[model samples]
Target: MAGGIEKLTALKVARLSKPGRYGDGKGLCLQITKTGVKSWVFRFERDGKERLMGLGPLHTVSLADAREKARVARASLIEGIDPLAKRHEAVASNKAEQASNLDFDTCVRLYIASREAEWKNPKHRQQWENSLKMHVSPHFGAIHARRIDTPLVLKALEPIWKTKTETASRIRERIERVLSWATTRGYREGDNPARWNGHLEELLSKPSKLKKVQHHPALPFAEIGDFFKAVKAEKGVGARALEFTILTACRTGEVLGALWHEVDLENRQWTIPPERMKASRPHRIPLVAATVALLKQQVGQDPTFVFPGAKQGKSISNMAMLMVLRRMKRDDLTVHGFRSTFRDWAAECTDYPSEMAELSLAHTVGTAVENAYRRSDLFERRRQLMQDWATWCSTPGVKPKTPIGSAEEVVS
Candidate 1:
């Protein structure tokens, strides 16, 4: 059998199927499982340890093909190289090449998909998709993500930077994020080309300089009492929710997403969990008499939501309160303007501390150091303030308890 090599032939390999490894000599073997599934394996040694490398299934890799593969592996072993390690290196290189070649459009899809779950709403995710499609995609989306450079980013942003400053700024931030994601995933490398600070800032004008600041139009604090009375007279769940929102001075999202379990009717409190809040901190609102009555009215309407939408098992839509304002022919006023209305009323009408008003609005008050030491939510003082607010909203022509010149020093 030629010095114990080439001991098995093609017919011998086909017939030797008794559930064990049969050698074809030169360390190449045909292995048959208990169920008669067969494949070729190459046995070798490197650094005093034994290894087996799979060739292919016996059905596809004939004895001749197996022998050729084994011969190449043996030659590698003789030359002080491990065939298995070399094969692994080749595979890794191929994968890295594939990763580096991923185009910008594909990277955007992957990046957005990865972050879709963390986003607040479908509209937010849609904004990411739409902005990139309209602005960035036309310029460099088909280019390899790794190959994206400063000029490419500039090409996408420059035309819109002045004419549509706010939109351009958002696109820049999003592009920076996608490139950063690509770098983390090994699809791209080098400093992010879309970065603003100390990078793109050198090329583009400051966003704040280009865009005008626009605040939501608010109803004058003096007119809020009449507005509240008009809103209370309106019929529907939205009107009730709007009434509650104004009295509590809450964000539209916070009011709409409220669940029955979050409300404590007996205690006159509504506890909004951190996840639902924009500041990501737990907020406790003291429910005044007006707010408690509003919650009571909503009880029989939905099993879960305090303000249920028309859809089964869903909360009220984000636009519901705004629609109520529009129906009242007050299209000039935004739902969020109510918070500013409350702030103005608290400053002009009440003797309560400014920090109390800020806290009631669920806004972060004072410096980080100040906040760290200030543990109190000032719930008791806040309760009294909210009661006074409710009284003001309910009673027409209520004058400021504090004189204009005698107003207490406001602490931010």
Candidate 2:
């Protein structure tokens, strides 16, 4: 005992089993809870009120360390500062720091959501999710965004870098974007670990050097008429959609996502909205008589979609045309390959200007400067081109003469 106060010794603290606070000299004490949990506390009075500050567990903090901490708390109280308030502020600051640090997967989702509106195609968002889930998520998803260093990103990319170069490149770009987003949002700091230009270029081979470009398998232009006939013989929304796709030389997604409102049967034109276009620009397709008749037949069946799916209020599956091809036993051909077939036929059989053929396919033609000077979409000339195409497609085994004039002269 010192100054009529019992000093808590290490031996006494270890032997004490009662659930009460046992005092030591200078306001330090050992607290034993009802559950037999033992911890150190620094007891003091400030502004005429007694306050107890938890130093730490008895097992972790030695008796000497607790006494030193008590001396510091007592000093703070003498200086008119509440030790409990100071401790609380420190704890809150640490919690705030932890709360601000987002994990990699969470950062990925936030980054995607922020840029969703800028993405032209709905599939682009899906592609981001699929790529990140397969490549980045398994390795670094749980790690704090700030802690994602170069080695971790390299580990995620190295396996796929050689085997799936294009996919690996896309994943690396996405990870870089997420990390950049985190840095800008204050969730992380430092140069992005996934940066490619000067940093990752040294680590991985150039994408161009590693990539082997593969084109879609297309049916020969001469065989398209026979294929069109086979598709026309089938019955269903998908069949009609497929036949319409061939007639217009449009992509599968374009035809399947078609809405009735976009069709102007009297004018013989179908105007695809900018959002639906692959180029992110509105496209006007000149429909021939055959296409107009097909639209008329499909009109009253569904009030919304030109090609309704099995589910209500939805467009047909993107796979619908492929399934039709499968049924026709043409497993080698893809629905998108028809556009290539159309391009081949225009080049080989017609005197149409190359620009018209490209425009009919809704492809962006010319450089930005050239496009700036060009104003017209040449809708009337395209109408004639499509009508001639319909005539050729309907009459199999017939070779047609060259058109009288070039597309530019015809349009003028």
Candidate 3:
């Protein structure tokens, strides 16, 4: 029967029994608990076994929708699918749609959160904020994901694509990423408007010419040992952080915001929490003996931070290291350029594996599946690499001919 609303109201409220059908159908069991709570259930066969799906309160789905739902359930069964599986699939699809309907702001925030360790370049972070502010938020920041289309994304990109091509290109990529997330969840469908394959490239300028790549200026690798010698002549937490940052090959912010808790001095390691890392995974940095010495020397300090700011519990200001460089009359050198500096040294001076060098910089390995299988963080390989780095800094131009220690023994 096509149970109408009137018939729905006329149907008696079925009382619950002990985990058995209530005469309606096989899975359509009503269980009235000993405590008087009433709930509905549907059961069906799939993969040679039985399964149950819950339909809500008697007051909620109502007898009418319940019957209507039951019909859909039976129809699915006739097609050799389990009604319970179908119900869950439908719910998952709906949840995916809800996630897709998430606005541009929501998705990008997620995207940024996702890029925790990957976006080590300071400019990468700046462009994320700048692109959203200058291009995206101006137009579609508040709009829901389902409503986004080529025209809207083009509007976001067209104005600055020619003039600020670099940032514009990155903005488009981020927008595409957000829409792709939306599309996967069912908020939007069809080709991503932000995508620039054969479909989109015709409408816009070539992204390469439009985009300008920015590089952080680092002192030459030949100058690194001298740079550290100069760094030691400086004062305060900023100097210590610079020394540590150069030694570990981490970013400036990672060094500045260093909390005491993250440091495992006894283990000679620093574990950066996922929330603090650019890649959003907790990463371990094996501290060289020199770096450990710096920490222990400053242990009795008031600020719990490895580099405390003027305010309590706050990180040292961004300018702290910059000003340190300027005071040393090396204003031309940047705090961030030190990473490239380390990379250059590892490449030119050492026989370290390329992957080990990259990990020292906290860069991602590859696809998620690849990362899952590569369990080792190559700590021992890096320990020797870092100790070699310290020895290099301990001298001016003399390259060390041999590896420092068995990579594992450095832990002691």
Candidate 4:
């Protein structure tokens, strides 16, 4: 195997100082750079392309060591193998093996960090971390992500699957996502243990079957007029915000995150951007005179927020309206429940079309195809419906003259 190898000796290599390659035969050479720094190189031709593989510097790799490395490379070439490509494969394998040791908690943190920017809401991010810490982390937070199996995932979810099905379902989804991310990153392999399809579905009861649909406790539509009258008489920004929310039939977060910039008093409209909306689509609310008047009362409060919090520059706390309800001895009612009240009144007591009521509430009216054809938000019709609602809300003992069974009733 020697052939023309061992052409350069140790004593000759040490004395070689010119800025050029000195061949030691068999694709091995000593390289002297322009800066007088010395290194060993293995120059080989693969598929007619010459490639230089660095062995090491003169200070680290001795002449004998470089010879042994070159000999191995020649042996590999004889076997029709590229030593450089083999080294790269070995390095990648080592990295994957190290990544396999990444713990569940670490994976969760990394996954959340990677996706944090995409999640617009701080509360949503908090829910992810908090739910995992409270429910999942306790079970197998320290376990290696690759080792997490169906039984381990079940251990975390079984206790809550029946008692807190919704939360358990969310945790299961989060775990599946993390495991999927780990798999993609080469930290884990195989199917996701937390998957709810054919895998976990056979083990755990369906979330829908385990949990009953729980509606927010709402005030009866008949009592909303009296409730609205009483709430109007109550003090603070919360009461006014609550009044505006009811009149607009908006969600709690939509009302709380309301900025003065979103409201156009001249146009009698409030535009909520897509990021803040539940459906991730922009919504336009047709404001009634009652809502406009209520908002006007709040003009001097804060420059940014429509309903300013006690602290400067922040919007009102999410619990502010609920606290107002508590103060009014209406602990049984939720701020969200007002939307149901409005929907009921629109369905049972009005001559307005159901689509008008749905549009006023900022709800999707029909299928995607139907919505594409029905381009209009029905703003003009919604405005009239909202005005009637506001007038009824302001009237304490007012009854719906157009009952569901009456001749004047048009809504079904």
Candidate 5:
């Protein structure tokens, strides 16, 4: 428009360009090429530096609109910003959409519906509904997803984080996930206000450090030596169940879901088929010496499970073992805490490799690339490690001391 742009004059820049783009003088110009294209270009010099930047082309854009764009760019330059930087800033700022007509309920419902089928278990769906009902829906469900900002998001999570840190952490994570979903689908915009990583970490205590989150209440690894002495002093189904858990490091649910077909005493392994695993993959748990000893002790038992319950095919209730602690007046500790107890002793008391420890816990080993190149599961190493873990736990008498070593909690 300023000079020679395919012979498009400043007076006719409006007529030549499209609805959304514009052109102006002062070396700022926008025009469609002979191929009916649209582009924004600015010709300018700053601090004795001259440069040209192509803004955009002119379909669905008008000449006057482009002139306004040029004015904004020039003003930004006067205020010590490069036009190119201003353009990127404008794009970023433009992401926050107006939400006068949006509703939070509909956004959450759609988010839940979109993800329901992908979740492996119904409890996943139930978790979504529970978070919404308990935390978000009560407050912001009536508001709009686009209207969700720092203060509103804080309101949704702060009360719960203050009182029930773990639940609040889940609710925050859930909201962040849902809001991210909405942003990609066009229901909202800007950075997620619910993100906890760099943003909310400043606002809230880490879930791991929070007392509510740490309350899985495990025995100190030092105390585990004494706990085993006490366990050997008493004998029953509950004691055996504790032995099985200590040997396998399996979740209470996974051990409960176990069946005779899954255990191969001959193979010395418990192949937890995919359906029983939280990860939905077949987990081959290498049987250690203690695990085999426990299974051999149960050989030819009438029940189908390696750890049998009073009922047929049902291993045992979670509460059955939990109640054991309650009866022993150690309700302060948890059944799942034994795994934490094992991890602590492995970390603080032994020279075991970190991968061996992780593999003993059945955790995925490395990064995707590293894992691709390193295919081995270190099965024998973990097998030996588990034997050592079980040996330490079931050790008869090491002068049983106070149950306190590595008091950190593990909640899975």
Candidate 6:
């Protein structure tokens, strides 16, 4: 409270020309910059550091206003609070409150914008936007995203939950993500009503219960050789992709997304990177002679994608393999079914251990304790099993004679 005498009048402040701190009284001063602009400042000491809090421009904040602000700031200093820090908190609180009023559509846009880069597939962004637009936005697009509750979410989901179970599930998940983003961004508060584990589970029947479990139609193990013959007879990138998929027993995405760089011809192996895999872990495949031959046929001098599409620098469409199956009039089987066929063939006709076969399919197997001890991928053992499978597929009428080795011998 001790400072310069109250020497500043409105007229004196208005006419002041000196470009320096002009004290009024009790830590209040008029600051004139070298550019001739004037403002008010309240000087205080906090934790041994001198701090200046801006009151406002002299043109807008009158002498009386500046004095009152300085009084409040001094009072806060006595209370051991930094008045400038308190003002910052107030501004931030106001901004958060304003942002919380953003409607569902706007929040969706912001959430997508913030997270689009992290999504692996560009099509995933389109799927999110389309699902929200088709199912959610029509009901709650204009409602404040924070204001949405269980009833509002149910309103968007109930009509389709039973009828379009898959689509409804996707919409519910997307809503949960957007609401979660909103809450984390300080735009919303409380539990996310869109969550399924405990909240929506009570409201809606389980998706599995609503819709019958539909497995991908698979080729029977005994008929794999015939299917392999038909797939090999066809030509084009799609056909090659399908044949490679069957040979490797990999997921369709892994085969189609394959690049020449991932293939090591010398090692007879294909390494699928973690990002493109379903388990999000790197999987190594032991390529057989036939698979290596197939890769040699598909390889070009400077290829980006092993299975190039109609568009330059792009992989084949996700539906390309399915169309191949359709064109061959084998609509009874799915492209993914080949994995099951390989699994069956390994289990029944070969002397390979189940662990080796599972590893061949890139599946996580064994108990946690067992896996902890099983550090190796059993890559060499799997190479022989895959070789036997490739030989069986290529030779039409020969039943695979089990190799003369016990599971223990091969695994050890």
Best by TM-score: 2
Better candidate by TM-score, 2 or 3:
2
Q: lDDT by residue for model 3 over 104-124, one digit each (tens)? A: 777677767766557655677
- TM-scores for candidates 1 onward, in order: 0.76, 0.79, 0.63, 0.77, 0.62, 0.74
Off by over 4 Å in 5: 1-102, 117-121, 196-216, 220-226, 232-236, 278-281, 296-304, 308-313, 399-412
lDDT of 5 by residue, 1-412 (tens): 2254334454665456343434356656665666656677777787798877765655544555656666777887888988876667767676544432357777777888987766766788888887777788878887878888878888888887767887787788888887898888888879999997789888877877766324467788767767766755556666777767766777777776678888888878888877666666677788877778777877766457766778776677777777667767787888887778777777776667766677677677778799779767666666766766776776644433433222231210
Model 2 per-residue lDDT tens digits across residues 171-290? 998999999999999999889889998899999899889887778888887777777777889989889998899889998888988999999988889999999888888999998899
**Candidate 1 lDDT by residue in tens digits, 1-412:** 7878777888888788699988878889989999999999999887788899999998999988998999999999889999989999999999888867999999999999999877765788889999999999999999999889999999999999999998999999999999999999988889999999899899999988878778989888888888899999999889988998989999999999999999999998999998788887899999888888878878888989999999999988888998999899999999999999999988877667788889999999999999999978988678878887888889766677563322343222
lDDT of 6 by residue, 1-412 (tens): 2346577998888889889999987899999999999999998887899999999997899999999999999898889889999999999989877866999999999999998867777888899888899899989988997799999999999999999999999899989999999889877889999999988999899999988878888887777787789888997889989988888899998988998889999998999998888767799999888998888887782378888999888999999999999999988989888888888888888777888889888888988798789879988888888887887787676665654336777866
List the global CA lDDT of all models. Answer: 0.89, 0.88, 0.77, 0.89, 0.71, 0.87
Look at candidate 4 and give me any clashing residue pairs.
none
- Ranking the candidates on TM-score from highest down gives 2, 4, 1, 6, 3, 5
The alpha-carbon lDDT assigned to residue 80 of candidate 4 equals 98
- Model 1 bad stretches (over 4 Å): 1-88, 109-122, 184-186, 401-412
Among residues 3 or more apart in sequence or in different chains, the pairs in candidate 1 whose N, CA or C atoms overlap within 3 Å are none
Error of 2 at 329 (Å): 2.4
C-alpha-based local distance difference test score of model 1: 0.89
Relative to the unseen true structure, what is the C-alpha lDDT of residue 290 in candidate 1, on a scale of 0 to 100? 83
* Candidate 2: residue 291 lDDT (0-100): 97
Model 4 error, position 150 (Å): 1.1
Off by over 4 Å in 4: 1-89, 96-103, 142-144, 183-188, 403-412
TM-score of 3: 0.63
What residue runs in model 3 are displaced by over 4 Å at the alpha carbon?
1-130, 137-152, 177-190, 366-371, 399-412
